[model samples]
Target: MTTSSNSPPLTPWGAAIITGVLLFLGYVGFDQFYLEWIFLLPLLWAIRDVRPRRAFLLGWVAGIVGHGGGFYWIIQMFQQFAGAPLPVGIVGLVLLAAANGVVLAVWAWGVSLLTRGRERHLVWIAPVLWTAIEKVWPEVFPNYLGASQYKVPHLTQIADFTGVLGVSFLVVYINATLYRILACRFEGKGVPWRAAAALGVTLVLVVAYGEFRIREVDGKVAAAQHLTVGLVQTNRGAADLHLSAGAIQQEHRDMSKALLAAKKADLVVWPEGVLSLGLPSREGTIPTWALGDLKVPLLFGACLQLNEEGETRFYNSALLADASGKILGTYDKTVLVPFGEYIPFGDVFPVLYAWSPYSSKFFSGKSVEPLKLGPHLLSVSICYEDIFPTHIRKLMRGGSEGRTPAVMFNLTNDSWYGNSTEPMEHLALASFRSIENRRSLVRVTNTGISAFVDPAGRITSRTGVWTREVLVDRVPLLEGTTVYGAFGDWIGWLCAVISLGAITLVTVSNRRDLTGKQNAL
Candidate 1:
């Protein structure tokens, strides 16, 4: 790609800083999502005339600042959850931001390599590389560029077909097109109206499709049966100095009783790990007092310990109980949080556990199964498991009966991050599960952002942070699955394959060119 002799007089570092800060603003507090559409312009323009190595460095610079700012809460998270000191927490955040930076660095390098001879293809090439790299790159907290647009329902409805990465693809596509237009003007060339027109048409079609789908999904939700669910948020710390296990349990029971007194509810849910004592995994072992006077079915997070022939196993689980306190079913959390729940490779290197003394050692659940409450089958996710789209799809896909989930439930404890944007961000990502599977999601968290999201990805009701709230809503029980629930991130997988092919071709071409030059020499 060619740069103008009279282009904007900004240095590469200046451009990187602008892109990075804009990206930070687009995702976090004061979320100006529109900035996401144009944030990449500066970096893309700066890298147009640079070598691949320089482009990669520029990309890393922008990524470090952007990711660092967006994920600043990591410091507090480590401090609270891991009990790490300030210096250690700061170092952890730096390492995290640097690691995430590598994804963008690869994208910039790939774009520079691909556009060596073909400059005009930047519009498509950049977006494809960006989407592909972001898809394949693994992170501690998995998120996509599309998540920034979570509040914008019209732009997010396409997730039912292609998942969140599809939304990321479209956002980058717009950025690349805008960059192309601006680059043309800088070089004193004619504006690429055809490219602009293509972008406009694509957006129009996307919005139009979103409009149609929203209306259709809303109709489906209206026609479906509704379940009155009560969500209890206790506003207690993850490990409070004052509250005892019995006291915490009492708080939930009191709130639940108030809900029953006001209106009837089919189910009442509590956040993850509220019950500190490990309940033995045996029939007739569930404490009757746990249910108290409420006659309704109750589901709450607890630790279950099973003693087999000669060993003991601990599970982070959600146990469902009948009106008389009979244990009906249990859905153990399948996707355990790294470090928070269990150390990665801790068993192999036992010393790692010694180094981080607070890390948990719980085992992952065996399968994804929905707990049945009467006739309605409830798909359950504990804590951050709801953030994973494919995992949720598997749970909602049904167990042996081949019947989809009537309603989805996520029991989470957000007290780990305190009063930060983490809860809000978590809510944003979890809301898509309802849209993809066309089920109402009832999320109950310990320290706020407890919400009810409908099939249209609309936040029906939500509670404030650090507040004790008893949210009662008639959550719709949906029946059908969308393309995403059935197929599972097919678009992202396709993009990854394309990216691998492109990287292979580029490497082969570079090697052939080097061989020819050596022969000439």
Candidate 2:
């Protein structure tokens, strides 16, 4: 790790910095241009000639740079939207980005140790190790690099069986292959034509498979049901959302009236946290009757409290009601938002609560069961839950049992990001979930991008942003499961195993070569 005087020096530390910048640029560039993927190359490059500790540090730096740059708008979400002060909001964003970066840093450290002297082969090992890390790392900032691929339908077809992990694996592997070819050419070493060829073949296969799946799913027309769905978009900003108790209740009432007047739809949906006033099940709390007159089974989001064994538990929940405004069944949000809903390791980080929006502790749901509504079985996804592909598959499969459920419902409030690309990005991810599970998704949003996506990831209908509008559309209730829904995330697991096995083989071969060299000396 030294440099020349005549030419610009490339120290290990300098390489680390370059790695971070390149990774950040790659992510930002890909996201802005929709270039499928390019971020994985920098991870391989960063650890190409580094020790384990340095590799870990480089990876961490790269992760922070990439996430911090890509999701910087999240700070606006915390400050202008969630009503936090500017300094605290910036710190929260940095903490989140760094925390996510730690996962990649660990992966780099592990791979560097395994391939100490065999840096040239990092192009093969780093991607697989990183993919495995991303797949198994329990929901600490669950939205990773590949999660952004939800919008690229052609590439996301692989998610059917592998979930999002499969897409991550493929993207990293492609980047690794490209890096290998370039490195070989740069050093005057013979080009790794095999790596280049393999990459080309894999791309073709992915594209071909995606094309086939698209055609197959598109050809089968869903028998359009006559059921009319009314989607309510509140268009309320974060400041408006956190108004006084009386004002909050009044807002819910006005939104309810707008939804009720929209049409005589069979089912009406509301965004997440529309009724943040209080839980309806709690004592002295305003009931659903106070909101508006309902004519059908209304599925709306609210904070609810349930008593179990004389103890009251509060939840961010979605409740279903009949035409007479009688409560039917309630679905508590199963996958809770990390810092937003409940802080992780709250025992250790007591001060974190001061920055959160909730005044009290939030309880997570015990199950991912679908609520029964007349003849239809509905699976519910609250806010960020829609981004997790496996969660949706499990919900649909668990709910469907042996028969196909009527539809999937998502209740979300994207007002956190205000008027940015976040809302559109969120909608794009939801579309992939719909396609992957072969189900129609009905999304009701607080701010904008409320719409209906059919089984093939096509937006059948949508609403304008920052507008108080109710959209009624006839959506098809899909029957039968896709290959992804049936098999779950086994494909991703298999890819991960293969990746690990490759790393093991490379490490063993390199170790043997080192031993032979020492003996000869």
Candidate 3:
């Protein structure tokens, strides 16, 4: 009896873990794209008619297992690059997993509260709840649920206006509809036409939007000005910094020279921090022409340190140079990485600052600045800055002090993730930024998946992973900004507002019912 009492809860634990596996198969991974449409069914079934607390626990398990599985590469990133101890890296991953699991736990709690001891019509409210949580999620390191369907062009078309939140809502709404229909059937009740109708209407609208948007884009692309842009993938990683920068610079020069000799490009872009070692001054007697003197201009990322007033300042900078090797202009990187670039809350906790790989703090650029390159000006984003949609739009806006660019350039180095799904995931999320602004995006990565993405979020030219290559493709420069650019993330805000308003109404209704019943008794 004493031994049995000391034993752990195997049955419940097993159920939770199993639910997580189901979620993973249904989400995204290794040719499981078709399974996404029905992924939530099993998780919903397991927690069906369960106590609110139990449901929340199950949801947390499923969330952690599924989401963590998608981003498991994070552990390798922490251990290998961030210099975290193996045990510490695992702990950090577990903590991240727990944080993600909490999002689903809260979602499950809402569902259980709404359906407990009452008709489950409120199950359809899952869309509202999901969109609300995702809207406020920090963009510093964003991972979207909708990114799972990135390969499906028709589904991603609506992202221009609704952003990724619209896609996430559609996914959850479908799950809710399926669960409700099945539950009603199991209970020997008539079919819920209202829930089915809502689901059908939502699908129809989404499909219709895709068709309309694609038609408009096709017409514009047919008659647009096509400019040849050269993208060089250095086949390098951040770890390569341990080696001398001369060899790395030589590789870039050789690649660019070969591509230029083969087909002359109007503009050439290199990956983030590709020229970190240092380039000699253009005015110096022995000036370095890394890419050789070409007809086309060059743009590349580097770290620039200079004195401002009495102090020294450091910047993650992108420099644009003319064909004659004259420095045109420089765009400083804004939206610096939290712990990676600078230690967060380091002033209060000095130990955290001491733990960083670098001693100097990188100063964030205050405004968006576009670089002039012959016929077109290019809006520049460095490293992880493109991940934030809001920040990207500000760069496109050309505010009062800035000029709008004909094209957008994301100089990134996703090589940090090694050979992982993160590179592809980042690519998918970056696509939306192009559609939202209705401008062509030139994404040049150090390793692979370097491509020319059109205004429609379609990849016209892309290179494979872990390869050394250069992609020279004709990309159309789109005119006029998208509605999403003018007014950003309105749909996300609206959905959040609707969810809060509905919750308030439900709480008031429940209280009124309780009061009436008490008086009658």
Candidate 4:
């Protein structure tokens, strides 16, 4: 047992609330990332002696508060994207909480199931269970627990080998160790010296590895060739706004021209959907005058409308054009945002469209190829696609020379989220892709947070929200794949497999225990 069986149990509601607030502060309102290391301790301690059902309830409550507060911008998103009223937006937040909150619920239930009588094993069980749940459980926002440490580059450098889950594992392990030490003191039990030593040794190794990688990556950055690119933020509002296509295109044209006039760039990039035109099939369809007479190659986002099998489909895509305004190549976004981009099962149940009148009819892209411009093989992700590590990795691994994209580019329009924490959170999550792939990332967005991320996941030339700004920077054109890029989230997968096996064994053991008691009775 974790605590003395005779000791009185503490109420869990207060602990759950404390943990929930810590989670919110850690990831959302405050920038105190240190809270992430201890956010789960309160919840873990509260649930140590509780039954699985009560444990799940406490965990779900904490998750609901955490996710609801962190994603409060979802209310504004519903208002802007779906034209929902304030009450509907509130409902959306509640629904989001209830849905994504299951991650914590299952995690708590799994912990209670595995360590019912052996609660002392929480130091060993909690980290793997949390990691596994995070890996398998789907989230609309894919906000990994490790992303909170993005600001602490030293702690985040290990992402190259183990992905973000590595950092999460470390955070949970620390919390568990600290909780165990505290629990022992409360119960008047012997100190857990082994757990403390293991934690100290783990921290030492992680810090050493982080320092070594930072030095190595910094050296590589200094020695690598650089690409001068111009990033343009148009400050346009949501896609459904009163802004006309002509106005949008003209803003991009003006910005691109101003950037080129001020400084020379190998390429100038525009935010997603700035062009607002169907990509022309034949050359010369996009007149030279349409590109603002810029002499350099332009990489911009546009809609690719195709008619195949007697059906018309629209795709969110990025297109490359040379100085002469001739089409070079195109990359379609393979991942589509549900409800925001297209309604799931809307075709079979057409009435679903009535509920979400503002949703788009865009189809998912079929390709993940990068557009080529001279020596630069630019891997492009449209909108929120950059938020998914696996998708970005696959895009990097695309082409005959697999995982050889020299640079990563993301064309996003974050106007749907308004001026909220969503843009910053989005930027934070997307930064990991740079470290995971060991490649420079240039993110251009409509209505702000446009910046350049180095191979080390450091942000440069960051622009604020709702601003019309032009940022010109020399970003490194990095090659070669890191361990994470080559192998993907192996650690997450291993933890998931372990969690599954543990669940199986626990179920069988519970059944046998019940059967033995029944036979003796």
lDDT by residue (398-512, candidate 1, tens digit) is 9877888888999998888877788888888898887777778999988888999988788889999999889999988777778988788888778778777977898899999
lDDT of 2 by residue, 1-521 (tens): 11112223344445555555555444422454233255555456557656777778877876787667756767877665445788978997798789887776877787777766565665667566767778666654465455556556777787666666677778777767776776677667878877778888888998898888778767655444546788777677655765754565566566656766756678888888766434436233234565566656778888776676678777888877777777677777888766666778764888877756553467877666677777777888898888887778878875535555668899998887767667766777677777778777999887888999877677788998788777888766656777778877675566568766766776798789899999999
TM-scores across all candidates? 0.95, 0.83, 0.90, 0.96
- Error (Å) of candidate 4 at residue 13 is 1.4
Give me the runs in candidate 1 sitting further than 4 Å from their true place. Answer: 1-10, 241-243, 280-282
Ten residues in sequence with the least summed lDDT for candidate 1: 1-10
Off by over 4 Å in 3: 1-19, 22-31, 117-120, 277-288, 358-360, 401-404, 508-521
For model 4, the stretches where C-alpha displacement exceeds 4 angstroms are: 1-10, 239-242, 280-285, 401-403
Candidate 3 clashing pairs? none
Better of 2 and 4 by lDDT: 4
**What lDDT is obtained when candidate 4 is compared to the true structure?**
0.84
* Pairs with steric clashes in candidate 1: none
Segments in model 2 whose C-alpha atoms lie over 4 Å from true places: 1-30, 33-36, 76-84, 110-124, 224-226, 244-264, 276-291, 345-359, 399-404, 495-521
Q: What is the lDDT of residue 497 in candidate 2?
A: 87
Candidate 4 lDDT trough over 10 residues, lowest sum: 1-10
lDDT of 4 by residue, 2-86 (tens): 4322335445767777888898789833668999888988788778767788889989988898888888999988888777898
